[model samples]
Target: MNDKKSVLRSSFLINFAIGLLIFFAFTIGLTTKVYIGGGIELYGTFLLALLILALNSPYVKHLSILSKNQALVLILIAWVLINNAELGRGIYERLMFTLFFFLVYLFISEYNEWTGFCLNSIKVLGIVYAMLTVFFALNTGLYVNIVMPVFADYTSIYQQNYAFLNGYLCGFTPNAAINAIYILAALGVCFSNVIVSNRRKVTSWILPFFLLGILFMTGKRGHLIFCLIALVLVYFINSSEDIINKYSKFVLITFGLVIVFIIAVQYIPALANVFTKFENQTEMGRIDSGRFDIWNYAFGSFLKSPLWGHGWDSFKYLFEPVYGYQINVHNVYIQLLTDVGLLGAIPFYCFFIMSFKHVKKAFKFYKNSTDLKAKRDICFALYIQVFFLLYCLTGNPLYDATPLFLYIISCAIGEYYYSTRNKT
Candidate 1:
């Protein structure tokens, strides 16, 4: 019931904390995966979250950081480690991620106002990300002509493959799906800035579509659709008819295209085939990318261990033997149920519910907020939260460090707003 003081100050130290996140995002493409002993992996973003939490923990010495119920998230993390059969680099990595994320959330939520700084960092990241996407997307030939010959030892067969460039634009990461999430987050922040601003800036209106183009080219069907849908919804939800009057026609045009896209992917054979090509590539003559069978098998695994679940990455062990290779389940919600079971999953998702609540509170409180700073920050926090939650349905952004870190920070800022709502 009591409000906690910010253990960390909003000066240079806070910038350092925010800077850690920026570093984590930029390095997603550069970092190699390494597993520590005991199935725990110390990753760039996860390490940054720990580092941020450690710096603030001592400052609040005896004070309890989490409200009573919020601490239950830690229990699910411990449960993952209880059964070694379910323990591995993936499982324990998630455990550590959950622990550090929540601990960091407690500390960082204290500085809700500092979120604008975080969004600024993301703006920088998004712009650079767009550049990287463009460069790499356009320069697949460069890697073949230069990188493959000079750095043959460094380039993997996958990277060396000339056809690799023909696929989605991955920017800095080897994975395009993860790259798309960052693009989505970047678009959310930049567009939020434009939407919530009291000033009239023409460039602000263009940056989001630019990012949208960047995301569209990634070949990530779910993220692209989700983004278009989000943009349309936010314009209506966050803007009044008169407020967005100038942009309404464009928004409606875009929304119409999005709806046509939805219809095309179902009723139109040519457009539907474009969307289903890769899905059918993995499974000849079949659509849904083989995800239907994966989800079914993974769900069956959950039935076997509904209480605690099979463990982190349980889907891999269950589906790999049948499928021959391991790919993510695609659906994070099913992955959670498959890996951790309903019991373990409840705690993991609790913070999402909480953070979203705070964002809703902030949105309500600041519905008429004129301050561009508050509006952008709150709107961005809300934007990415909704994206992340929904993307889990047919995508796995949470499995990657970059998007997870982005989502965690966005949500924490919302929590911050809720913590300070009454005071303001």
Candidate 2:
């Protein structure tokens, strides 16, 4: 048993290290010139997960967290083939990525030793990613013109789209909104790390603030709003602490942070510009910026084939003329309802239901957990879950591979730690 655990540990750490290199390789580039649509770092991350599972081939038990997901791939196939739907190569490829990431998450979840480690990794990665994002947002003009040659192609596109606000901060990412999806995901992880920690540090609190600051500059309205919601939820989550410490203190801290940033906006042009855009859009009564039109279109389309979606990314052919190159429904639930239909979305829905059940249990256990590591991991997993659920209200995270994997990884982490709490 000892030897087996050691080998599993070795495999996980080795792959995690490789994952870090891939993260920087693609992320630091002026543009992910190397990241085709799927995001190369995501490939490295999920492929490394497969490597870990491959190395730990002899399993004693199945990952219960995956039981509902067992039917997702099958449901997808039958939904597409049965409808005689045109499953384009791109959608099919992304679906395959979804399947692989889901399976990899399932297989590796049983090895619970790494949950704590991953929480730490997410914290550090979130901070570093946030710093890079903030710097890029503030210096978009400098970088686009002088530093990163690869972003030249998208220079006109970015400038035109962001003419209202500070430039799209996620200039280096595959998609600004998609980048915001997982960055918000990471923000949840780090947010919980600080809120639930037994030993809080200055950096722990500062990290999420920095991440939130950069997210504002990105001008991703959905991500920015939902991320704040997730943070407030984290602060007030029932913990084995006095009401003042857990709730009152957090409320005060959050209030203070908001006050500080509000004052900072008065002085910081970049931050001030974000609010100016929001005000300008609101005054025009176009706060949604066309998302409502897209959602209405996708929802009505889903009604045409309510049982299963029109087929994966069915909107691509129909959407370009209507929405101008935007392929997603910008809402995952609606996307599922549109892509596979209600019948096909059963498994996908079940997967979230199952994960939510675990998260619900994790929150219950968190209130009483004396084990600090378990508490932190459990909270880390919980907020990541919250981030995804809320983010799905206005974003198409599932349509992108990296955010999809990050979302599922949170489910796995939640399930693993929740089960451990039950066992104890």
Candidate 3:
């Protein structure tokens, strides 16, 4: 009776955890006034309750107190040093956000291993959001001009007739481009696993169509280029034993078929005008123009505060806007250079490089492990983390909630795998 009850409790907790994670992933990035009248503290209130529970749990205490996260501790110290020095406002802004995200990771890992639920939830939410956004974007284009007033400068009262017909669309964050990238990264990791074979095959069939939908809907060149890069990397570097290797030829063939289908659709004269927009680069102007100017500004600021940084996230206000008001650098490497100087950033660089090397080794070590479950879990954790690191280059995934959850999962998995080896 006790054994059955224990199993039931575990199953319930896992299911509940998954539900909460899904809710967070789909809603965190949204700016909708879901919590009206400054009720945002509701989210905070729930988090505080979780924190209290975590503090009381011995398992949480053990996992949270790992030496592996020392690299992140250095990051916080660096932030304080720069902030105390009053070097530049940019450094201060960057540190504040980085520290906030860092704490989130620590808290989650310390609480328990939350990676499986968090990642699976993210994958599910991403697909749902992408489809919903596409559906609405198409309908909006048909009925009205789809005048995006929020981004008046970037988006005019343009007719989107072609957008409706082609099935490419998005919402406030734009047509699921970012979400697509996230899903692609998840798919890479999921497919790499030796387990989950049936689910992997289903995703393989669905994702190419999803990718095609994303490409057509958003008209975003960046994601298309990113997809191509990922494809090439997986093709050249993935081992035959890796899940991607098994499906590589099939994936490539599917992509070719998608291209042919797109061309066939373009035979319609109405769609020709829409496809022509692919050659246009007007939307990317702000990003391109700011690239050189931001670098020039960051370089001068960096020289003055070589040791620390201008202050986290303070790039624009403190540095004198070369182009416009400071926001985010949009590039992690550049952002790190300006936010945390070489003294601080080097530890992070070392941590990632070492972690990847370690994970790759762990995946190989799986073959020799006596315990099959432990071996598979270790491989799953390591490969998933690798996928996130690769995706981080394009977007600073580490700066947000989902990214923090992933790191926590990675740390917990690493600790469990290595400790078991030690015991044996």
Candidate 4:
């Protein structure tokens, strides 16, 4: 009945709600199969709404520090509306996910302490996933060792791949390529901020090793390229005492290349066997099918509804009558344009542009910020944002919940840091 008691009660509820969200997220991730048929709606959307309500309690008046990130929010709203209009649905229907996203955005932005907790939680999740891999290895006799677990619903493709590169290891996430890209993004963040390289050599070594593990497990070409880009940027930005640039970036990269060369030379027999399997053509056939059927059809459909998209989740339906292929475009940009038309895409572009601008400004502040910790955090945010921008070009950024969460958190953190700086 007391105000203090009420606030405490609200806090407990909020924490419980968030824990549930995280749990379901983990469950859905591990299950790897579509629960479909309203299962997602009941468990996912309802709990999300409850979580939002708990956070919006009057007891927690100044919930998020999102005032600083208002520009991004505005841009995103504008884009969603314009895009949805093109699809003949209002913004509300087309961008339903944005509704829940803003709630999450607010919770993280308004609550300062939760940010630290969330960061630590990610590391915890990584460790839990590592354990799951061991469990999978033990339960199933598929692989020689228990390094990663196979999802109950996932195909065999995930367990068969193991080729490391650039210090990334992808142990979980059913779609290895997508999982690798996500890990690489996580690595960029952890490397930039979580670990203080100067304070501990072990932290530095662990960061790269985990990254290597992720890259090897995923076997995704796009992720490999992105990791290389991240390495160059992280090295150059962090290398303060060295030459104008970090030659270590070049040298390390060359070393990786040389290692690949030597491995190729020494294991030509094994490599030949792998290459022989590669020649089977099924993989290329599937890719070619996607390129012609999904990609091309989506492009043509986008032109028809250039102003607004056909509808949210409506592209496959719209295309089925024409292309006879029931499939997602597998490209975020195209997905956006098809689902919400040109009007929507403009706002989407604005949201992205503004988010990057804020990140850039934060990076510039590093030069003037006297606080070493603040400088490091800002630069770290910049690296994470860079990873998002680069990864979206090749993959549908919002297809997975992780990327959406990453973008929202980045904006939230950037907003708080910038606002606090201006206040002083």
Better of 1 and 2 by TM-score: 2
Give model 2's TM-score versus the native structure.
Answer: 0.82
What digit string (tens of lDDT, one per residue) describes model 1 on residues 1-424? 1223343352456667667656655555443332223233345546765565556543254575665324554564466566434445534544455456656665676665457667777777777877777787668776456534543343455653632444556665555565677777788888887887777587766787677767766777778777766676666678666755747777687788688667754643333422544674656755576788888888888899998787666677787788798777889988888888888777767767877777888877877866667777878878887888888888776676666777777777776666667887
Q: State the lDDT of candidate 2 residue by residue for 105-204, as single tens digits.
A: 6554555565655555655665666666666666767555553455445445454345424455664553456456546756777776676666788876
lDDT of 4 by residue, 1-424 (tens): 6998977765655565555544444443453344444445535654564565445543256443345356456555555544343245332322454545655665454444444445545545655564444344345444324323444344344334432212122345554554554555546556666333446555565665555444444446555666668656655665564673367656776799668745764643322322333343365565332445576778788999888677555676776787665556767777778877776666666667766776666566554555655555565566666766777766665645566666666766665566555654
Compared with the true structure, what per-residue lDDT tens digits does model 3 show for residues 11-108?
Answer: 45544644554454345434233334333443553454345434544445565345455446546555655454334322332243334344444444
TM-score of 3: 0.69
Clash totals for all candidate models: 1, 6, 18, 29
TM-score of 1: 0.80
Error of 3 at 366 (Å): 3.5
Sorted on TM-score, highest at the top, how do the candidates line up? Answer: 2, 1, 4, 3
Rate residue 328 of model 1 by lDDT.
76
Q: Output the lDDT of residue 262, model 4.
A: 58
Q: Output candidate 1 Cα RMSD.
A: 6.0
What CA RMSD would candidate 4 show?
Answer: 6.1
